[model samples]
Target: MRGPLVLACLTLLGAEASAQEVVKIGHVAPLSGPQASFGKDNENGARMAVEDLNAQGVTIGGKKIKLELVAEDDAADPKQGTAAAQKLCDAKVNGVVGHLNSGTTIPAAKIYNKCGVPQVTPSATNPELTQLGYKTVFRLLANDNALGAGLANHAAKQLKLKRIAIIDDRTAYGTGIAEVFKKTALANGVEIVDQQATNDKATDFMSILTAIKGKKPDGIFFGGMGPQAGPMLRQMQQLGLGKVYLFGGDGVCTAELPKLAANVKTIENVVCAVGGAALDKRAQGVEWKKRYDAKYPGQFQIYSAYAYDATMVLVDAMKRAKSTNPAVYAAKLFDTDYEGVSAHVQFEPNGELKNPAMTLYVYRGGVRVSTN
Candidate 1:
């Protein structure tokens, strides 16, 4: 009897090890603000990824498993990002998909790492986030290094702009991108004529534009989101500075930007770069985008596809490691290569995307037109 009982217990333990369990993936992003539309689109993309995974009847460790999403609103604020991260960590979730803004993502990275939960941000492009050397942090988005060079290359090689002016919002994402663009632009022979800073909530750019216009630059590289980009473009036109190209990072790449572009036709010459595959152009993304529209219409933000991929990466890593405990999976997460809707997924030693891909986008008829 004792021998039979021992064998039964062993079998049960083995079954548990091989069976699928409910895994919860967390999401942290700004759901409301001037950037609220961006967060909404990102969340929808993340939701679509989770839904697709659940629909597929995936087998994990020889047993059926499903993905669950635990979402929180970070409001694109640093304090809120930390709070949202602590909430997800307290929930003991297996992984987190976001905290979109660099300012928010930077502060929350430490919190997620401390809790032993891995977070993959789709849109936060600041270099400092990965510089901390935390093993639990990861970013799928193209960082400042890639984006800055792409813009500088465009300005120097394409636009042949011998001189350019630069501006930033001074947040982690803004300052980092601006600095990188300035550095690479200098290396590419695009002289940095003038540099200025602004706040995220600032709507007025008259003074900055006036000062920047004084230098007579061929282009203006703005390292900030759409809120400032729209008005700045308008003011540039107001000051009769339409000839200069208005450049920015993904922060300025959103569908909602056109609403603000009404007063500035010269925004047509605007160029913004993002590190993700064009959500509007992805094959799997096509269906996902349609479904997203059906569920939540007219909201297509940048990070959504990345957020979805982030969730899928976590689940796949868990399946490969055969453990829900992040410590073991975290070790294997570095090798994550899930072919996702956005693109083939993998991470580098710093937890950044394995191969950084940058897309240069232009505003054409108030739409994001990919010019390669």
Candidate 2:
């Protein structure tokens, strides 16, 4: 009698396992390059969301679903990003969560659209991304135009810096945000004293710094990511330009920036903008951060929360549609008005975040603190 009861329980467990439907969600990011830390944080966020959803035993369309995260490493390269997207397309993933850089995400977006897979970017901030008119594409953060203008306004109106110089890495994201900052700065009566271009991979910014130092500008705006911004700040300190204000868009804003600057005095002079509310300002930020910290352990970066929110948004659409089919829920994504941890997640007709929010930050005691 005891043996018969045990076998019956085992059969029920096997039946439940067989009945589970696996929903594959693709996540692409630079998991093995200069921006690997950022990529890993994003991957972790997506992974955690999948795990949580699985633990909750999500049931979609009358079937218990097991969420599977198919993560790919784009390596921060455009070619690799497209390859990753193609791989996901071939795998028939239900949705996608990343491609952290705008350079990577823009190219990958076309593939996702062609494949009819819904793609959501957690960190790419370039405005040109959504302008492609791909209904399948969605972004979770404010675009570069908002970030650039916000920083420019703060510089011109609050800080009252009139003489400024601009530098860009020439990437889609860097050049785009820098141009917007330039336009806004000029419109606000700020005089542009110098302009320079640098590649994202170049570590030595001494020549450019030396060139800009001669102009005696009150502020310097760099449009690049943290890997470049960190050394740029250190070189500024070495050139005795530590007191000059440093401004940048979301690309330059990161937890690793201070460490990259090697604790330089110029770190405090740095100001940057990210495309969302600061954690402290968000209603759920403190509790959400605690959960993230406990799960990832000291790995909170700028975009992980957005990545988590993006994952949730994607899953929420799936649940709303009662199906994991991309074709069915992609329409629901356009009508998205979900409350995300960062902001109320909604998309405009152009696939841009509705009423996107931008937050400015400054370095205080080696920590990036939000100003508003």
Candidate 3:
């Protein structure tokens, strides 16, 4: 009798285990390249959400659900980004959380849309992303319009700079923000002394800095990531342009930028904008950041909070829809009203975050200090 009862109990346990549904959330970023730190930080945020979700025990359609993160490395390349998107789609993930740069995210958005997977990008800020008109595409932060214009306004109105030079890495993200900055600065009566372009992989900026320095501009704006921005700062110092203010968009605003700048005094001249409020100022940001620091330690960068919110927003939609099917939950994203660590998550008709906030920061004593 004991043997029969034990066997029956084991069979019931197996059945119960089989009853739980496993849901995959796809995350794509440049995990192996120059921007790997940003990518890893983004992935860490999503992973944290997955851990928290599973710990809380998720149920959808009346069945216990287990969440899983399936991350891919896009190498910050557009081609690889699409490939990662297709790979995630083929894996039939219920949703996606990234493709950190606008250059990558723009292309990946189309593939995810075709695959019926909902994607919320925590870092890609180019305005063109949402203009693609895919309902499955959502941005968790302010777009480049806000970031570029904000920086340009500050340069023209706040700093009262008369002349500014622009250097862009020529990626979609860099070019987009640079164009907006140029336009806004010009409109505000600040002369665009010179405009230079380079590819994303280039590390040298001496020639361009020399040219811009010759122009005697009050400021230089770089539209690119920290990898390029950091070395650019050091090179600017080498070129004796340290005192000239260096302005940039979110891509250049990172915790790693100081280290990348190699302790250059020019780091003090860097004034960059990020798409959301400073974490220290948000209601939940301080506590959330403490937890993140304890878990990831020194891995925190600009977008983790947004990435965490993106993951939570996706899951919230899934729960509200009571289904993990992308077709069902993707629609629910349009109705998101959840409060996130970064900001309150709500979407405009175009899938842009509603009333998104932007914050400017400068380095003080080698640490990122919010200016506003």
Predictions in order: lDDT: 0.84, 0.91, 0.94
> Compared with the true structure, what per-residue lDDT tens digits does model 3 show for residues 1-372?
569889999999999889999999999989987889999999999999999999999898899999999999999999999999999999999999997999999999999999899999999999999999999999999999999999999999999999999999989999999999999999999999999999888899989899899999989999998999999999999989978999999999998899999989999999999999899998799999999999999999889898899999998998999999999888999999999999999999899999999999999988999998
Better of 1 and 3 by TM-score: 3
Q: Candidate 1 — which pairs collide? A: 30-75, 42-304
| TM-score quality measure for candidate 2 | 0.97
Q: What is the full ranking by TM-score, best candidate first?
A: 3, 2, 1
Provide the clashing-pair count of each candidate structure. 2, 0, 0
How does candidate 2 score on lDDT?
A: 0.91
Sorted on lDDT, highest at the top, how do the candidates line up?
3, 2, 1
In model 3, which runs have C-alpha deviations exceeding 4 angstroms?
none
Candidate 3 residue pairs that clash: none
Quickly count the clashes in candidate 2: 0
Among all candidates shown, the one with the greatest TM-score: 3
Q: Write the per-residue lDDT of candidate 1 for residues 70-174, one digit (tens) a residue.
A: 889888889989999999999988888888899999999999889999888888999898999899989887899899889888889988889899889978989
| TM-score against native, each model | 0.90, 0.97, 0.98
TM-score comparison, 1 vs 2, better candidate: 2
